[model samples]
Target: MTHQRKQIGSGRNAIGDFAPKLAELTDDVLFEDVWNRPELSPRDRSLITVAALVAGGDSDQLRFHLKHAKDNGVTESELIEAITHLAFYAGWPKAMTGVATAKQVFTA
Candidate 1:
């Protein structure tokens, strides 16, 4: 499947300045290629990405992905439920952090 390059955030632009090749790979390979695979819908990919970010306590990336998740059709209730369900396995602290991040994303 082919996809238009996604404008994820400033990180890609910053990386592109220093390492254009890496940035190309990120934009072309990761986002365009892998993320656009027809096997998974964008919403499903958002759910998986959000869960990974939440599990790893990656609030910085989580912030971006949360917005993407909502744009991809993941509902507020679904995001809350995912975080709540992950708390037991990923840790309460991480889930708590996710909740705070979610609030910021949802409110914004």
Candidate 2:
């Protein structure tokens, strides 16, 4: 399962034709190398990523990470709680958007 996730080519599948280098880097470097680093579990990384994405008001990417977070074992309530907690630090607007996006992800 770990090895399979590492070989993912979501970057390629999404934009390889227009951005080959980025695809390679996203697949080979980001996913394969960085994500596979053993220090932090994938669940930890996914949660961190979801928080950053929410804080940054990056809903586009957050959609994917929300799903990834759940796949990594983060519960729906946990995600909502995290987003709610981020409101104090990440601001109410961003947290609201995160909740909205999370709703879409979890329900779908």
Candidate 3:
């Protein structure tokens, strides 16, 4: 038996026309290859990705990942708690910003 990874076209929808190569790489390499690896489930990947974005204070990307994380079965409270916990290592300001971003995503 074999498992098939789900297909996603977020990259092309996001930036295919502006940067074809990046879009293709995002669609093929990141989403198809990296994200679909058997080792980690999509929910786990979403959590890690959200943490990275929060640590880097990448709000723009964080917005999307926040929703993505939720869609992947991560609860809103879990996400909030994760961000609150990240404050210690990732920095207070970054977590504060993450909170703001999370608030927007949660409400919207």
Candidate 4:
């Protein structure tokens, strides 16, 4: 719990009251409840989240999730393939944006 708080609230040097509660929900519900589900692996979830973020043009959040995706075993090739596949159905622009995000992720 302390470790989670330290990581999440460290940037601003304060918990901001809501930080604790946010951490609780993130730790207890977000991670433990949904992320830990056996039906989907962490890697798969990260991949999906990154893709959604890319589609939504949420680059700031996408960058974080891209790193998470890489950490969880989402390879560059796999990301490229996913974006390429998404290009057809989800629209080229969105897919292109995903490719740009992937490029940043890979370069970093």
Number of the predicted model whose TM-score against the real structure is largest: 3
lDDT of 1 by residue, 15-97 (tens): 87898888888788877777877788888899999999999999999988988888888899999999999999999999999
**RMSD for each of the candidates:** 3.2, 2.5, 1.9, 6.0
TM-score of 2: 0.91
lDDT of 4 by residue, 4-24 (tens): 211121212334265777666
| Highest-scoring model, lDDT | 3
**Per-model TM against the reference:** 0.84, 0.91, 0.93, 0.71
lDDT of 2: 0.89
List, residue by residue over 43-67, the lDDT tens digit for candidate 2: 8888899999999999999999888
Off by over 4 Å in 1: 1-14
Better of 1 and 4 by TM-score: 1
| lDDT string, candidate 3, 4-104, tens digits | 44636498898999999999999899988898887887788989999999999999999989988877789999999999999998999999999999999
Pairs that collide in candidate 2 are: none
- Please provide the root mean square deviation of candidate 4 (C-alpha atoms, Å): 6.0
Cand. 4 Cα-lDDT: 0.70
Q: List where candidate 3 sits over 4 angstroms from the true fold.
A: 1-7
